[model samples]
Target: MRRAIAGLLGAGLVVGALAGCAPAASDRPLVVVTTNILGDVVGELVGDQVEVMTLMRPDADPHSFEISAQEEARLRTADLLVSNGLGLEEGLQQHVDAAAAEGVPTVEAGDLITPLAYADGDAEGLDDPHLWTDPTRMVDVVAGLTDSLETALGDELDAGELAASSAAYTAELRALDAEMASAFAAIPEAQRALVTNHHVFGYLAARYDVAVIGAVVPSGTTLAAPSASDLDDLVSAIDRTGVRAIFADSSQPDRLAQVLADEAGVDVAVVDLFTESLSEPGEGAETYLQMMRTNTERIATGLSP
Candidate 1:
């Protein structure tokens, strides 16, 4: 009888372990996102049907963030990998490429949008990777993400349900685009100038009729520093144009912006916007939509009288 009891106890332990290892019935597809912005977009698209994990933390620089060994393991097992693809994730390119080589489905959201070339003489000849600056572009990304989700989730996702949800989200982004255009239209054409730390907002300014007066770094990528001549040229341009505020990326250091602001002697408010990645959950700029809205409101407030 003691031997029989021991066998029964062993069986019970095995059952408990198996039960613990089983995923919940409602657990959705696993999605690993390379950046917070893409994470937010995927979260909205997949909703309750997918488990989304963002690699980059809030306010982390996309060009500099490195993935850990544990993160690589997660990537290997994730159902999908979504990234803000216009070369923004420069540091993680190798890992993403490896995932693609291993047959993991990887979606590059920037490919859906018509990329805007960086203005001549900006950082490293790199294309502006901050595509979400334009809300319309975000609508396109949402559609691409929806397609990727449907492909990954297969019959697990209801086709009609996903389509309807994507349509609703796209409509919201369209409205945001209109609202920003109208608000920025109110800024005087002459004063509609931007002096940012880097050339991250070339598309933004171009879309809204604002002039990119000068950038402290004067490069498309934020990984480079400005030479003495670059700083001198920016200072001269700022003095000549009478540009007001100098916008800075939330993830970049503010020392350069501060120096420019001090030298320019203008009301250079150090506006920190989510240019590279979204903020953490509960922050104002946590989601892609919120990030754009927050940036629009800030830019309008700064540039407007």
Candidate 2:
């Protein structure tokens, strides 16, 4: 009986010691990412170095996707909060702000890159928040994000490994950029005009020298409804520009674009693009790289004039 009691006491002490050595809630560093694009980028960069808690899911609209109160609490507890600033996350701004108010280090990926403004429509001069449309800009975002992660994570992150991972990812972005450039080069200059559902492709048009003739909604965000005048103007522009294909965001209803296409009386092919969100597995775009590649291929095929 004495020997059994001694062994039990020893095991209890060992368990206590193990419990004492475990990391606390605050000590266990976490990264909360807002948009899935940035979430995926951060995941690729951090890679098990720290926990990445992504708030938004695949195929969800960033402009209008809201988080629950629990997610807001998680945001506040993060060691670092990474978001695509420039007001891209319009719906989740308050939650992100709540986290920042609690002293969480925030990295606005949009602010890190060279921000571009809307080239046309009512949103002109407003900073275009769709920087990820251009992979070169995403490369810049990736570099800035790496620095931000290192600064926020400090010694918790392995610098050498992070650098290597970042370099590899940046290389992939560059490669994708080159491939896109080569593909867009095939588009005859006359067929390089874009007329999408909204003003989401400014960076892409700017990057590839494609003309932004018009958008059905006449604004940057999908929430904006198109006025009759706006639709009329777009129809005129589509007819005038000889726009063979009109790209609609898959996440949004194609009803507006269809209306424009039918009213314009043009043989415009309304192609669907995963502009603001990623799709589920077995779908065309599941990752950031895959999304970009798929968009490029679809754009090429749709507007091959």
Looking at model 2, residue 305 earns an lDDT score of: 59
Instruction: List the candidates' TM-scores in order.
Output: 0.90, 0.91
Number of the top candidate by TM-score?
2
In model 2, the worst 10-residue window by lDDT is: 22-31
Instruction: Flag clash pairs in model 1.
Output: 123-219, 123-220
Tens-digit lDDT string for candidate 1 (22-132): 986646678899988788877777777778888998888888899899999889877888988888888999989998889889889877777888865644455678887
Instruction: Put down candidate 2 lDDT per residue, 119-181, tens digits, no spaces.
Output: 777888999999999999999998998999899989999999999999999999999999999
lDDT of each: 0.83, 0.90
Winner by lDDT: 2
